[model samples]
Target: MPTLALMWEAKAAPGRAGDLLAWARAQELDPSPARREHFTAPGERVLVITWWPAAYDAEVPELPDPPQELRARPVHRWRFEQV
Candidate 1:
């Protein structure tokens, strides 16, 4: 079986990175991934990467969008297959 990695990144509103980070951390995906990682970067960017046992194009669970007020822009997502 192949593995898929889902990446979700978001930028937080001014002075709200902490809140956005907390919100992202609190989100739960049903049938959780095999592995999950959370990251924060400069400019209040939050990135979450989840690894799952599935194909690259397989439909899988992903984190939902945070409240609009908490984000500076729309969320960005991508899926990649383990090579």
Candidate 2:
């Protein structure tokens, strides 16, 4: 089977990057991933990527939203296959 990668991204309110980062780090995903990573960017952005072994048309899991008060806006999510 081919591999699929799913990414969840969000930005925190002003001066709340650290809080968002902490929350992202402590999260766990069900149906456990084969690999994953967390990243932070300037301007209070946080990103998480999870990798799974799946067919091209497989149904990937969805990520939950973080606390409403912590984010600047709703999360953005995407998925891609290895080229």
Q: Which predicted model would earn the best lDDT?
A: 1
lDDT tens digits by residue: candidate 2, 1-83: 79999889999988888998888878777777899898998889999998999855678665688898889999999888977
Q: Candidate 1 residues 1-83, lDDT tens each? A: 99999999999999999999899999999989999999999999999999999999898889999999999999999999999
- Which candidate number has the best TM-score? 1
Clashes of each: 0, 0
Worst 10 residues of 1 by lDDT: 56-65
Candidate 1: residue 26 lDDT (0-100) = 95
Q: Lowest lDDT 10-mer window, candidate 2?
A: 55-64
CA lDDT of every candidate: 0.95, 0.86
